[model samples]
Target: MNLRRLTYLGIAVCIASVPVLAVPAQPRSVEYRSPVDLVLLKNDTWLVVANQTSNSVSLLETKSGKILDEILCGDHPSAIVACLDGQHILVSCAHSGQISLIQVEGGKLNEIHTIDVGFEPTGLTVAPNGKTAYVGLVATGEVAELDLVQAKVARKFSVGAWPRYLTVSPNGERLAVGCSGESKIVIVDLIQGEIAYSSKLSGGINIGHLQCSADGKYVYFPWMIYRSNPINRDNIRRGWVLGSRIGRVRLDKQEYREAITLDVPGMAVADPHGIVMDSSNKRLVVSAAGSHDLLVYRRDDLPWEGVGGPGDLIDPKLMQDRDLFQRIDLGGRPMGIAMARDGRTVYVANYLKDAIQVVNIEDRSILRDIPLGQRPRPSQVRHGEELFYDARRSLDQWYSCHTCHYNGGVNSKAMDTWNDGSALTMKTVLPLEHLDRTGPWTWHGWQEDLHDAMHKSFTTTMQGRPASPREADAILAYLKTDRSPPNPFREKDGSLNESAIRGQKVFAGTEANCISCHNGPHFTDGEIHDVGLGSEEDEYQGYNTPSLTGIYRKVRFLHDGRAGSLEEVLSDYHSPEEVSGTRAMTESELADLISYLKSL
Candidate 1:
């Protein structure tokens, strides 16, 4: 028999042998009172850290190592940037979908205004003149230009899905945005009103918190290796996955397209974030979020460079000797980072521990821990989110749930975990949203309970301890609260537009019937169907129908990521009926249908 027949036979035999009630219950839950970004005051006296988990920003006195204040803000404050005025700060609150512009006068802050941007506004970059600011909207794949003069969003420009970080050129004319959701960087020309470049990166996932060089010559970010060829997890011990890396993009006219990759061969410095370079631009301080450690490396210290050059190289094994690498343990999940003017002290936002650990770059040692003033122990959702971003729960502190989810979202990469007894079969990272309403977890519909999936992830994927009963409840609470972000296709009145309404009728029709499988409030019928789509390594007779509420947010489509766009979703990969229906659909009608689906 062929592979398809074998797959059907295997599922039939397995179904006949096991019953639904036989599946065991598993406990789990997930948190970052997650500090996603930070900035230093112009005077350099205090550093402000955005606590996405706490909905607060903590001010730390650098000299005294004291928490001067923890000012309450909107929900999920992800990014903070110090404007040129020295008294103004722009903070992006992700959960609230607003950018709060706070004015600091004398010694206090004045809430100037909160401009409602869109869903999941992440990184922001202020112009040197402080006249304009650009905010990255993660969900809508657009960047909003905020005019500080008017205290409002001026214009929004499309970039890519999940524009996580924004870095402005020194001249303030060019903007480089790290589109993490799509694993690419989009360079926008501010004056011309167009994208100058959209460079696809290698092994860059959840790429955020970018820092430009002093001369504005390049941008550096921490990324991970997911393997190029289709491969199994068996080679994980051989560095096939969970590999450490630092990527650099040269922007000079001579080397505008040049890319550089650096790594310490065989080292387990996973989940790189919070990177800062010293004044001389030699010493580099990077927070390995997954390992709970800070890596200190000097560019000159690399042994690859010959006598007298910058050693422009791309060797992954230049720093193989462990003793040659200067590393420090932060003992917590570090996310945001800020460096002193002189570059002697580096401040780190320890998201999980609620403290700011200051590291002296000179000796690579922890100078002090400035408490953000810990609140009560994390509640269920809070605890769950912290657990979600934390790597300590994994074996040897290898990586955290954020390694795959990015920020309770998809990683835009595929992996073969052998979870379903399949080898050399890759599955795209499914998004975690509208979990409570969407029943039967995973694409195969193996785990009926979300908590059970969490337990399996911890025990199997992370190779760590199974989730406790309480932990499971906390994680589930977080999943429920982590609703799908507001889709951008809604009308001004928050109702379906005429095109979408028309397309809705088309969707319910028998020829282009989408409601049969994608039905109800969550847009899923909670059923599996053969649908004539199966591969050789697929162990299931059918695939679980997924929710389409935030379908526009996905960079790839289907379980194996065969479709790269929404238009492709209606193309050859679709079932015969859908293909025929879509083929007969007029270009305008097809556009309307797509617009309608995205509005969900």
Candidate 2:
């Protein structure tokens, strides 16, 4: 009961509320279309959208919005779950790694099987007796499972480095997944298929869509914070980088607490790209997708509970605001969320208004919205086929490193401060289709390559100014052949991550030593470590030790946001000695050394 008296008794039970700042329910001009992901089959009366760049999967009928069948496939489909008794489906194509299986019967969609397995498959679930299906693959961190009575592949496991979402718990044994290029979640152990546990939903930033609840206890996730500062002035090249919240993570005792967190005062836009769990009205649905909206929380208003330890969730008044959820203006950009039989009605898939919005979790309402096509984006294909992209080169509206690394950025906070010698603020963005084998770019390594780090991040930090230089070589040829977005927490092949195995025994032991330099596989051993917060006499004295991959969508800590959080970047700037490599520990061992640098 001590750790500062349980952090003053969990901030006096989370400062008794007082954190509401939402306001953006007045722009209703809805024509709808942008369905990224949704599925509420059968009981909710069918809704299935996975339309990424319009390859197609429509089929909505939830009480008359019509469009009861679009069913095309391949070119892009991107993730969908349900199976057999629910009417068999399983789609995941995202630029063709393929995995269709459709078989709806009476209400259309009968395409049976397609199976390919490794290049894009971008996450899809169905193994709770639905006859095994997993998928994920995304540039191979691996997962594939499948064998729905011999549909194919049946086994393959790896787990980390870029999984987007998996979930199969409600007594299905286990299989958590969620890993957007390193920062941990990887549970896996479904009847010993492997990886028996690991957690740290990137409190540093960049972890997305992990959802689970039909009685699995709790697991919802979708965080992204990508900060950047550069020299602030309400955005020098882009830094605020908001939205995307809902951490939760409890699986009996896997831990990592402080459930909900997303405030939207004035214009912060909750962001959150997808999360689902209506579980018949306990409610959780959140695809806050950059403030276009569709959020809702309930679950007795989630906040710190048993799984609350790492800096034990410093009470920022329990976050959650995008106007207290229950709002639906499905005009465009609403990532994903799914539920059917008894979750009290749910379904949303509106990536830039391709359409599919049938919510109504007990009057928080929206109920009918079914349009689909022309540059939409959702996939989990199965025999339909016809996805093409050209919404003016969709990076959502181009120039997107997700605006400044949002969704795939984990959970951001802010602070770019011009560059390296400034200190460091979640400075990693790796995951580039296996990142040309991790080369030299920012954080002091400074770009000596990758086309001069894509001409200083596409002409001075993504300004683009009418791009040129061949549209930055077609956006670095589409970020080196995109498709690495599905890692669903890879691990089922040997495990590790009990606070990173007690944070690698205290990050290489000796109270907070931090392995002297951080180590490899992108955890960073690139060098440079001064710590005294730089600028003693400049000339790059030290700092460049970035790359924790998706460092929990970093927002601000040093390099200029000057430690706004992450337990104040380790209990007020690395405590141990004074030389300043910053890591002496204390404060519950710096939340187990940041839960072991987020289990990377």
Candidate 3:
């Protein structure tokens, strides 16, 4: 089936499955206090959940519901996977690009070894035989394997774009890696160390987390398609920041097939956050970050029916009264998931909830909820060296200017919603890499100097202290290395979309006249234009065209986010109402121009 049809079918099943019940929300207990990742161990008696934000792990007594111990790790600890014996833990610290080994014996944890990896090791898994542990480097397209026996590096292999989470098959012959950048899956033959197979999905970008069915017949990974349409320079800016879907691939085959994929049913595909498999009873659990709900799919039937038959999956007849087995409400935003050995329970890590959610698998019931930390964002590792401990910012509480503008690209989609939102308008967050080279801050090009803009924006908008002369210098030091997130959407063979190719012709041609300013890798000529489009609030009629690197992550266009879509902007030049004084263009030309802008 086509991706659109598959998406609808999955949503239809979910919608049909709902049965009304007067179920009361469960009470909150066993606050995580900083829970990151969880693993079942010691014959299912103990559960170790990574408290990465707080640099520790919470040991839990599963049967007794008791907190056993809180073992500390150094710096930013992220993912955690257990050894085959379940007596040790491997965690990655992306901040320092290091992986840490923590030995667990007799209910206590001890530091073992620290091995340095590449940029941002976010996902990890131990081989079935407990001989090798694979680590996914988020920023680098590579996987690093650590030898379990010696607790040292075994080997590393290059893979597809921005590998996030990885999984090993039960027999230990095959390994699957998920790439967020290219929206593809690469399966490697462990013995031969060669990529045995690969599956590419359309609308598949930013793919996260891979899960293998208990029988090892099916492999599942969450696929997200960023909305891509290039109609105008403005719409190209909006890009595909928001996405949707839960996708599965057949592993036995050498080629990838789109099987049993589900859309973000009741909600806009904000982010398909997490995936976990309950091996005991054949349950597939997915956490939808947009809806903040845990979705359950049962494998008793073919194509893994949802709650109801086909259309009933959304509101499954079998799950109407099964609160514990269907959907569970996480108090806040849910991001990650892990299952217990027996499949009787599943653990959820909430990014915004600041806690870990424990759910009973059989009845779809939430058995316990534990509070873990503040602002947990899918951590997977712990490093041995204290590299980040003495950094400028303290461990407990210090948010960097870069925190908001990740990798200098403003990776997030949040708007400046402060009361004085006008001053901190869309133009305020202009890219800094090309500054000095690119004049002014904000769309209006109001502040000419870099120092003034930083001081005013940080103090007024961020509610941050106005940096002292020395402090401002330090902040500027951090801002100077501003580089945009790399573009993975460009075709693999280096071919541009046909429409985008046409659009490119029109862009530089006189018909569009867009190339007068927007050009280069940054996609901006660092020049301002009147274009005859501005509001009364546009104190300055002209604005600097911002860089296009990762423009898909941006939400607004122009100085005030006035343009809603790229198509609107391209078509606006023709609309007397919106375009006002700009030159008019035909609809076909507009579409072609939009296709071109998107190629960028």
Candidate 4:
């Protein structure tokens, strides 16, 4: 069979064929201004947006709402931050693993420097003195501190797993890093250059942008809490299964954290991304990316601690108070927010609409929608991408498909979505990179029909209205476009290293015997086997052989996430002696084998 290579976010993978409706591809010249993050630069006169898909940055005049200029940068620019000097801004190019520093010179953006940081640089922040900057390296699980003057990485310190965002305290003494994979907030003492506190968020996932208080007392962010209960209507309605929250971590102390539930009886917030506070600190705004709205809250009036007593996450009386909180609906997905100095006007990076919405908090209305630039016409794949991220598709607008499979990738947690025949059977979220080629969906290899599986996800797992046939086809089209990121373990020319090359021999040899069930280009035979890893609660006795293509991206392994590392998966649970009835590999052999697996 012939194969075609697909590349997204710098990662390339081979697929046998397109499985869904073939949408027309856009021209390479047409810019898709998927504005993910933005910041107010040049003293609020200019709004700078990080156009993710376009691989550029757009500088817009705040007053006239005109696109001043679009400057090309590194690939997949994810976040932008204005420097304290008011003349330069930094953009974190995620796919390129580089930070582009641009100077704001007389209404024009000039690329000054490109600092090669590390893999997946997502969040960025500058210190009070503007001398140093911090970047959250997602894949490396470390925070890289850059010396602004030197234009190079000064040092790196490990925070936690997948640090997606970072915030610096007002005093510039502490930097709070949000580690989404581990669901922990690591506070780095800038003065001492070490981790001061590591506050774990129980059941937290998808931790969003972080904003430190003016007084340097707390760091606030938006995140989702997963309750591993059966996917039933009662649990979903009561916000017991999956819910949203705005969490805070005390910077002055260790392991001190608190959160307020953003969900009410009927209405709930989902995929809360960007968060900001005004200069006066009276208003707090959070962009609900999944729900496509801006949640504005009165900062002082929020019931944080004394509302319903100890261990109370939500207060009914406070939730019913409309004056305390207001939701302003914006049609497109909102990822980042920039508050004006006036404290009422807010700018939102609307991803789907390819525009920035200027919202008025006092009147609770969208004042204007500033178009970033011209984009391609909407296709079935585009609509499918919208549906995949829209939380309104779920019951009570609680979660979207992206809530679990983040950006068509996997979340670090195993969830009991109840898609299988049994309940309470937690399974790791499988990545949708090559979903079209990987037939027989689900862990048990039970979902033979892809369209039926999509319908069941909406109807059963999400407990929402079943998708129409057309909608399902659109989703499938979007999934076909999804691809895994470039494996960092691979060489620059995409060749295996010496260790991996040696390990590849062992994999094909009988000692490891890994190629027996996993013997395809995608590394899966598409067959189910009794791996002896199933629990008694599992309805299905055998498990499907999963593809090991992007196994390096996964922090948790196995069907139920029991194996924390690839070494654990090979040495402890599914060892050669246990599965293939062979002798255990030596430590050197195991190390080489892991290196080879990561290269895939």
Top candidate on lDDT is 4
Question: What is the C-alpha lDDT profile of model 4 across 356-440, one tens digit per residue?
Answer: 9998899998889987765677789989999999889999888999999999989989999888878999999998988988877
Instruction: Tell me the deviation in Å of residue 473 in model 3.
Output: 24
lDDT of 1 by residue, 1-600 (tens): 000101101111112222422211111002123566777885688777787765656565677866554444666787899874777788998767888877655444455677888667888888778879999988778999999888788998899888888788778777888887677778888888888777666555767577777788777766665654333334444455556556566554323333323334334566787787877778777888877788776655544321232222234443564433567888768878888887768888887776778888677788888765434555787777767777767665556787887667677877665555566677887778878778786788777867678787887776678889898888778777854555667864689999999889878876677787889997888888877668876876678888887777788888888888777777457732554444456667677788898888
lDDT of 1 at 410: 78
**Least accurate 10 contiguous residues by lDDT in model 3:** 1-10
Model 2 ranges off by over 4 Å: 1-34, 39-45, 49-59, 62-80, 87-124, 131-163, 167-178, 183-189, 196-350, 354-399, 408-458, 461-463, 466-573, 579-583, 586-589, 592-600
Tens-place lDDT digits, model 2, residues 266-321: 33334466877665547777765545666666666555443532222222443544
In model 1, where do residues sit more than 4 Å from their true spots?
A: 1-34, 65-71, 154-156, 228-234, 254-267, 302-324, 378-380, 449-452, 468-474, 491-493, 579-583
Residue 223 C-alpha lDDT in model 1 = 63
Stretches of candidate 4 exceeding 4 Å from the true structure: 1-30, 306-314
Query: Worst 10-residue stretch by lDDT in candidate 4?
Result: 1-10
lDDT of 4: 0.85
Q: Give the per-residue lDDT digits (tens) of candidate 3, residues 1-600.
A: 000100101111111123433212121122224455677778778777766555556666778756655544545566788884678888776655667776777765555667766456778988888868999876547888888777677888888656778888887878889875555788888889978888776545446578887777667776545333322222212322223455566666664454443332323223455788765646777775544567776755425322221221122343344532465666455666777777767778764455667887567677877654223233221110011111112111112233234334432122342322352233324445554455645665556777776566445433345656655565555445433333333454547777768777877776566675677766787666676655564446676677665444343455454654567656654243333344566777677776566546
- Once fitted onto the true fold, the runs of candidate 3 whose alpha carbons sit more than 4 angstroms away are 1-34, 229-243, 261-269, 300-325, 373-600
Q: What do the candidate models score in CA lDDT, each in turn?
A: 0.70, 0.56, 0.57, 0.85
